[model samples]
Target chain A: MAFEIHLDNFTGPLDLLLHLIKTNEMDIYDIQMVEITEQYLTVVEQMKQLDLEIAGEFLLMAATLIHIKSRMLLPVSDEPVEEEDEDPRAELVRRLLEYQRYKQAAEALEALPQLERDVFVSRFVPTEIADSADETVSLGVFQLAEAYYRILSEVPAEVFHEVIREPLSVAQYVQLVVRQLADGQRHSFRRLVAAWPSRAELVVTFLAMLELVKMRLVEIDQVADYGDIWLKLRVAQGELAAVDLAEDGFGYG
Target chain B: MADLKRLAEAFIFAAEAPLSFERLCLLLERSRPEVRPLMQELLTEYSAGQRGFYLAEVAGGYQFRTDPDCGIWLRKLSKERPLRFSQAALETLAIIAYRQPMTRAEVEYLRGVDSGGVMKTLLEKNLLKIIGKKDVPGRPLMYGTSRQFLELFGLRSLEDLPTLKEVSALDPELAEAVPLEPESDN
Candidate 1:
């Protein structure tokens, strides 16, 4: 409580608590809730006085400590402590321990001979452009999902009172995607889903595209981070017909 | 064997990325068993600490890197950007690295802080990647450490990180209980 804590010293409430415990030389398992809570509140008060905006998590932990402190002040229940009546501090302690593990792990990571930071690798610049053939990397499922969500957001929200529309199947979308790439040119994933009229149809088309990628019929590539994802046919044009578009027992319903 | 060792050393030196054992085998047209000793020879020779650079095993592959002691001299030659991580970013990374394929909500819960900005920064830095979508109702994207993460940490693999006790073991009842719905996604 006597020591001044800089606002920038702690990342969060738990981080502050750990520092307090260490500075106070208190056992983590046997934390004196009353004393620790007072110190924590003092720090929080100091943070408040300085006009440093306290995150909700810090306030939440403050409230938790006060609540636990009050519980610690209550009269001892003679009835007996059982599993159902575990210590209030148990949960907090568990969380603190968990956070401590990760914090230590993070420190261990920092201490490693990190590339670019601790060790330097020779920059191997290939003078010939041909030596560095592929500038693009394969796109991940989440990247595609992010693209789909962006496209979905642009589509008008599904009207509650829906009109009867023809059912769209993944099978049909599969053929559509195949035909789009039949020319053996790179097709934009966004353009493929951009035309779908309904969310349901778009989802089906998206699933179809995913299926194609899974089957190795199509490959998704992004030239740069946050760039447009392009889908190219993996098989030759003549071999496209030999590929099957059979629905593998999944219902769109 | 001598020619193979020379080729392996040259290839690793010239390669932009860390050259994996499998790739090295393919390049040398040798079986894994045959290539094992070739890589070992290079690893041993450079590991004596006499050379300016050492063959480092990182990100599950080998790359020629200047020794840490040489970093002072190397800094003068080129001014490559040094990687820096805020405590929050490192904590977030540690949580994800330990509990991978995790949703953002889980990460936030563990850190007890809103992690959207940190997660975004990690993703932008290519330290974290979206592996897939969680199957739960909201279909939140699941995140995992990327190859660059391992490379940056000089980790041979995720298993090489310091060992941690299983989280679920901290509370038996918590482990058995159904996962509560993730806090409404930010």
Candidate 2:
């Protein structure tokens, strides 16, 4: 496009009208027909010359403007074509006014305080596992688990395809991890993830860790300023229950 | 059968994004106390076997997702549609996505142009959000990329962004037209 139009305030004819009003400081009800029409035409001409992909909204505004300009030029225009009829610019102004209000409202709404919304701290939490081994590092199981789950929410709705297959389970590795933890009270999360053979094993291992976290049967901790997260068998009351990997579904990947 | 496990599975399977325990609870009309444990137990049983897919939480929700190793294959599968966005939108979005909690003024200041309408349009498309008010004289609305931006862009985090050179190479002309500053890649 010759005129780098980035789908700005004029996604629709309505938004363009609002922008003209706000930027040019013209009152909606009393739009200076000659000047307003020229500015609107400038945008349309720009779009046309640049071969910008104009949305229908912009076209609709152009047609409305031409009609208003023609009406403004009609003989005895002040004779009042229809006393009860809408002013030629009324519909456009109405759209402009409403859009302006909401545009401001949207800005205002954003001005209010937000809760739980994240502003990226711009600090990277160095992956502890990466410290020991730095290669084609796939995302952590938890991160992948998350990325997989929201498959469609961020993607367009039309892209959604139904899945009829059953979910794969990591029962074997889950059992193995349980066993390893049974003998020892603690183990490195890095070691566990690294031990997995395939992507499936890695997922299963993470799932086991998640299950333990949920059941409160174990606690995975990354001490402040510490690197790797450690998984320790959960303690009950005042006593740490001796881990029993053989009884639970824990095994190697 | 409406069994709790099946319900959870269906929710996970049918979801377009992760379904957190709270979301599952809200969707199922079950108490969190009951559903949380059910999720745990089901998660435990599901993990006790080998499978390509696993249940995990991300974006503050939970859903069934394929294993990480499958990302390459998954990317291939998703590449079919080959999502497209206008260059100006992407440049404007890149600035907002990574360097957010920022205002329209700041965005324009960095990009050196009028983003008034571009910001508005992005907000309309739900690709960006008005996160909060900046502590300035006007308290302009701060902007950030939305979750929908993530889904469409296929970015797991801001860090998922390609190296500046690589991303710039995708459309060198546009990159030259609107070269982004590397300051905010922090």
Candidate 3:
């Protein structure tokens, strides 16, 4: 609450929009642009009156609002509206919709069991406490997301040192892996990536295997005991060369 | 017809859950530049007022699913009396998957559940493990997910999951298909 008052001075554009929406109880979809524009302009007026010079960013938003206001004022034609000729509110609506989703996501995150040391310590899972542990031994190695998150926190955010400017791409990593695995040599998963220059490279290389798994590019297995985990390329270099061809067949488009 | 490709249909068919751009590209061996716009175009065209089904990303991969209106049919298909997953299970699973090698006490604290039994079920299901023991006061055991999870869900890897929005978009069928349960299984 204290932060809200202070943030008003340096708040971002979305914050302003949200403020206006809350204050006026404005229906976001059917906003009274003229009224909103008036109030918005008044804020600028107040800032000027207080001798607090404002940035051009707010002014730009004001101008954009004015333009949209004029368009909203325009009369509807008898001819059907083209998809492109829809209300200027469309883009604004899109952003508002997106922000709404983000808001909901943030709320959902709030409800999540925010745990310490990977264990939830809240009154969160009472209903799920029922156990049926009369079963067999299980083998799972579940560290991935948090592992990366920790890695992200520990690594320097900005790598100024020009270790390797070019990213170790998924495609190239796959090639390196396929060749090494094809050479009949067992590659230690831990040892294979030890020489990587930096953390991001390590991440990119890890991501490559993940991509391969998605693409059915390789088979990863861990036999009984703490033996060296194995990853072998599924096919030859020529078969693997169908990178572009994948787009043609299974392309997202 | 040579230039025309039913890429969307193909993606839905192959993916385990709902897929993301990065996952899709890896699956198709394409770059973002070549895949994103085309996927957008295809998504718009395919889902334009369609009723029986919708394309969306969920969990971490894509799959063709029956329509939401047809959820009653799907509900019937699972044949477990629509046994909704327990919140404790979902919470514990999400916690373990997101933050793993955790101890039983750590899970109980986060879930606020005496998760000894649920942990055991997950263990029996081969979905969890005692990834060595912590050298703490009680020397508690740590838990994590198994590779069976990826295989069971038909995912090749964890990177297959899109962001939340993309996941929802990846599987609008399930989005609409869902019942009004208080908590969705994570």
Candidate lDDT (C-alpha), each: 0.80, 0.58, 0.55
lDDT computed for candidate 2: 0.58
Stretches > 4 Å off in candidate 1: A1-3, A81-83, A127-253, B165-186
lDDT of 1 by residue, B1-186 (tens): 658889889889888878899988988999999999988888889993778888888888998887877766666776656778888999999999989989999998888788999999998778899988899999998999988888887788999887865543232332222222233444
DockQ of each: 0.21, 0.01, 0.02
Ten-residue region with minimum lDDT total, candidate 3 chain A: A113-122
TM-score of 1: 0.66
- Model 3: per-residue lDDT, tens digit, B138-181? 88788876654443333335554223352221222322322322
Docking class of 2: incorrect
Supply the DockQ value of model 1: 0.21
Give the per-residue lDDT digits (tens) of candidate 1, residues A142-196.
5566779999999999879878866777888888989888988999877887887
Query: For residues A1-253, could you state the per-residue lDDT of candidate 3 as single tens digits?
Result: 0011222322334335545554556666777888877767766665676676665656777887899999988887889787768778777656544543443333333333221211111122233332332323332343454457789999888957766465345556655655566654556666667767577767766766666667786777778678656676776667776654232343323
Candidates sorted by lDDT, descending order? Answer: 1, 2, 3
User: Clashes per prediction?
Assistant: 0, 29, 24
